[model samples]
Target chain A: MDVGIKIIDSRGAACPGPITDLARAYRNSKVGDIFEMWATDKGVKADTQAWATKTGNEILETREDPDKIVIRIKINKR
Target chain B: MKKVLIIGGGGGGLILANHLDTNEFDVTIVDKSDLHFYQPWFLYIAFKGSKRKISRPIGELVRPGVNFVKDEITEINLDERKAYGSRKVVYNYDYIAIATGTSPDPDSIPGLRQIYDEYGDYHSNVYNSQKLWSHVKNFKGGTIAIGQASPTCKCPPSLLEGAFLLEERLRGMGMSVGTSDPLSPSNENDPTKTGEKGKSRIVFFTPFPRAYSAEPMNKVVEPMVKERGIEVMPFFDVDTIDVQNKTINSLEGDSLKYDLPIIVPPCKGPKIKFTPETVQDEERFIKADKNFMKIPGYDDAFAIGDCNTLPTSKTGVTAHLEAMTVSELIQGKYSEFNGRINCPFDTAYGKATFVIADYNNPVVPYPPTATKHFMKMSMARIYWMTLMGTADPIFERFFNITKPEKLNRKYSVPE
Candidate 1:
């Protein structure tokens, strides 16, 4: 989807960073603002989805590319 | 099925209550609080580093095959193997797992109880993550004092994190930090080191001879504290808190004053009426052998958790690790619990350091990094998920994942 997204490039960042930043972006963002995060922590992808489900946000897409897992999330009003 | 009674619905107790086979054991879980909270998150909440709703009603969380009882336990007749609760209810168990945990006894300390009676977990209970949200929300910058009201509070790294988080909280408010002129650097705890016009100074006090109880962590933390411009006063035992004067007096003829004191009160054990054999000290911390097995005399009883005199840090992680051994011990098996504490220390200015230690080892210095902080954040979710039975058990066994060891039950059940 063609949307203005904030790239939270937490590449090489650890566990909480990716999701913590994602939560922050979700808070600061307007509806439809996508937060795309890149993290080297292998658990980030699964955790991101889990966080999304808990917070009532949507994980738009998750892709594994190169050395990091990339996740895109949409800020939704819960 | 053997009747098992698990006391307290917190960390170690809850984990054991969830994992124990219902088909083989009739387990009953009782706790005073109707609600169960994800406690470790209280650090983030108190520091204003993160805001997430981390609580759930205990009624909803107790899994199938476990009888949940919400009652204030009045007494435990260890000799009779019976626990008495409010409403004159009596419970008999063939086996018991005590995980009642520790407490920061404000009542035992003069002026501290008054402080709580006035401020209500201003530092301690919030640190316990029991009641923290409003405290963190209303917090503004000032001369913040993070001190230990007494010795051996759970999670020694807490105040260090509190100061670090407060530093970040104040700075995030556009406060000038690190410099006396709000621009030029002075020494640690310089009067003009915070807020819009330098309205903050962070002072940390501990009863320990060093910044951390563990010496190796001190080696790493002392320097970091210096670099962050945090002042530390060690070997100071807080005896009296003269709230009227805003000064805490030490037993050793010294006094330190503060505008806001975020202190860890003295940790005291629960008042369970266990037999002398079941407890270690006068405080009633449970007695478990090195392997966290075989509580002397009561062969049917196994104890683990912060309430135990485990010769380790009284932390949720420690209790979680030891729970594995306690469960096996109840089943006539022996499992050695290598007391481990994996902690992440946040400088709160977008930086963190991970501290990994065991019962005997002190933590060596490691660089503050984002990766470690991330792990700390992820751990909370993983822990809760595992407890909820949605996540795999392997998630809870993070460190033990790779250890190719035997899971053997060395002892046979008493026929």
Candidate 2:
């Protein structure tokens, strides 16, 4: 079964704000679920990637549009 | 007897030096420059006719017992626990406190120094009140753009103060005020050129999306900017300056031209070579434990003030509080240092100001108000008096003494 978690894209929320919100949403999710984060900041791509790598999660896919970007991460079921 | 050596004789260094007991430890303060500036007042000094009142000789601020050295520190040899100076003197320390506050590097931007050289002789880089007053008195008004080049820049309110005070001073000089579209090049190529000859327009640009990144303050400042008719352009990094044209190009493809531009260049730690482990974060700012103010892996080395990567605003007040905490730790009287820092700011009549950060939490966050006006003024007086050796004992006691429970609470934050 595939579960989709949508994080309202916090594109321009400034430093630490978007990161904090993403962490909160990720924490509330179950193992093996896909968390989708929408962010508008160019810095968020590297930030979210770093966050995933540090947490041992895997990025399933990332798609970017002009104004916003959507990132999908697969949580490790540790 | 443990010897405490403090580098940089600015607000943070001086506060730490004063808080330490002279008899117990031999404290030596070293700074490269001969003059110690009341830096916060540079804004007012630039425009007001009272520059002399704001700056005092560095010698006046040192306590009777402290040894002051006038020399530039070239390097900090942490492995050997020594600092070398241009005077060829090497001072070793039982405890070292780093408080060399931030310095602007104008060289980082193209054409910045040239523009500054041509147009800024009347401005104070540190404290040029005469220059500020001269610029204000010259009176022809055009677009005034204030921009911060880096995220770690000191004192955002200073830029706000410049905008407000310039407006007030220009109006008093019989110049009219006008509003232009936000000064982004994408919106219009020439915002300042479109203005009338005698009218002054002001535009403020920040790299961040909001006026102030910190909450509540941002909320307050955003509306205040709107109310004051100051154009706010957020999230645009400055790419370069066209010195010939007096225009600034943004990384986001926006440009702004100004008649007089007061730029706050990016600030960085003092030029010091340190091992990766000795410094913290991407910036080479000396790293200290969040609570104890101790450099990790080194017992005797510590950092306080803007030189360190403290989470709080890089103001004198934060340094003073951290100095008290670090002094206690150095004397072995306290096992740990703990305190919360809250930077309180005020915006009055479109001019913004800040007061001593009230660390007593839950933080009482408020915008600049009437009461804060007196607080800011009195605090400036306290700073001046302390530096001048004339502060009453009561002010010293209030800042130095801390309750045990508060200390314990602060240490609870994980490093």
Candidate 3:
């Protein structure tokens, strides 16, 4: 809800489903486009971080709310 | 309906397209040829069976309602979710399963294609099985070398089968078959050379350390080679073929001269490009999940069979099981892919050897038996039924057990 951020609701999605949504979102995002994925799947944290690290993106912020893990990623040309 | 497009109509694609729910998904398979041949039958075809009897038209194979396209795939863009074909047809899909499989690129090896073309190396499978027949049939009987070009060759046991069957053929012709290499015996302690010149000699070569990895298989095969007087030349990593010298030099500082050479040329993966990292091995097999579902970086792409490095035997049976797993994963059913491989190796004259393996136990090649020969024949029929989609076997339980689907018929050739 800031200057430029895409909030992806992945609460009910499965392991790769949410990760896939995160990837698809990253695919469509421009440079400096921020993304926050709210995921209920516990594996999403590792998957997302691994994907981001592999694809050369920056993780802006990460925190776990009571119900789901929230991750913030910045789209880098890297 | 989710649109599923599959490339390569060999085993995995054929089985996957048939098993995919026609009601829930629009399945289309794109392949260059309208022919889907049972590959194992190539061995039989080279010996006694006819090519026409083993290969069938692709038009008759796929289940009804599944669309088949006769176009060669030129390029696959995972990011765009599109595959370009030779006919210039561009197709998009919700999901794509690549079962392009491995190919023996003789051209990839310097002078291999030339030597094969010049002398007619028929021991090779996939191609020249028919040509091998003519080569064997016209044989007045000398030395026939069944050797591998490298370690990455798919289905190494099949080479043993070719040697065994051809040895039996030469023996049937009343020619002395030699298993001991007169040129390069393992050591002085090894069996003495048993064949004189002009008699048919069968020296089998491989890059593997042993004839078969498992001890029990070694007990059987080593003795089989010794009994039949066939020679074993292991640790030969051939790099180039000097056809004039009738010798093949190896990358591992080894060389061997041969009369007729059947080289399973160093196999390479399909030429299609993928954008994902760690998605393929250095040799080009797509790295796959145990279940053969979803390339890690891409959302909707998956790979099966020899095209994907699943650590299973790169055989049609492994591809068949992978197809079942793919169906279970996509149709909203649960499945776990563990590496499982079973191959019934036809030894010759209505006899065969059996291998059953998994990730935990690894490769355990069991004893040879006549029953496994019949079992292999039964597999050919099962292959037909699978193509026709008539005898489609499905997973009855979601347990992590390997092939709860074929647990019954499995006992016919139980490990």
Q: Which predicted model would earn the best lDDT?
A: 3
The C-alpha local distance difference test score for the whole of candidate 1 amounts to 0.64
Q: Which scores higher on DockQ, 1 or 3?
A: 3
The candidates' DockQ values read 0.01, 0.06, 0.02
Q: Ten residues in a row with the worst lDDT in model 1 chain B?
A: B404-413
In model 2 chain B, which range of ten residues has the least summed lDDT? B355-364
Candidate 2, residue B251: Cα displacement in angstroms equals 2.5
Tens digit per residue, CA lDDT, model 3, B93-177: 9889998888667886677998666544433444577677777766775667786666555564677887888877776775566
Q: Choose the strongest candidate by DockQ.
A: 2
Model 2 Cα lDDT, one tens digit per residue, B1-415: 7789999888778877877889999999998876777776666666555544655666768878888888888787888888888867888898888888876667777977775554452223543345545666775867878767555566545555666666566656756555643322233324435455666677787665556544334555677666555777765456689988888986545788888776766667778666435475445577777677778888888888877755445666567667777777777777443343434354544333332223222222244667656766666667766643356376447544433234335432322
Identify the CAPRI category of the predicted complex in candidate 3.
incorrect
Q: lDDT by residue for model 1 over B1-415, one digit each (tens)? A: 8888988888787777777788899989889887777766777766663567776777677678888899877677667889888899998999888878876688766788776654444334443333443544455555666776765466657767877776667656655444352333442444543432435667777655556654444665677676655677764667788989888886545687766667666776777666554465545567766456446677766677778755556667667777766777676676777656666677666667655654333343455677777877777777676565556456447565422121112111112
Q: Native-contact fraction for each model?
A: 0.00, 0.02, 0.00
lDDT of 2: 0.63
What would you estimate as the lDDT of candidate 3? 0.68
Q: Which portions of model 2 show Cα errors greater than 4 Å?
A: A1-78, B121-129, B180-193, B275-283, B335-365, B386-415
lDDT of 2 at A72: 84
Q: How high is the DockQ of candidate 1?
A: 0.01
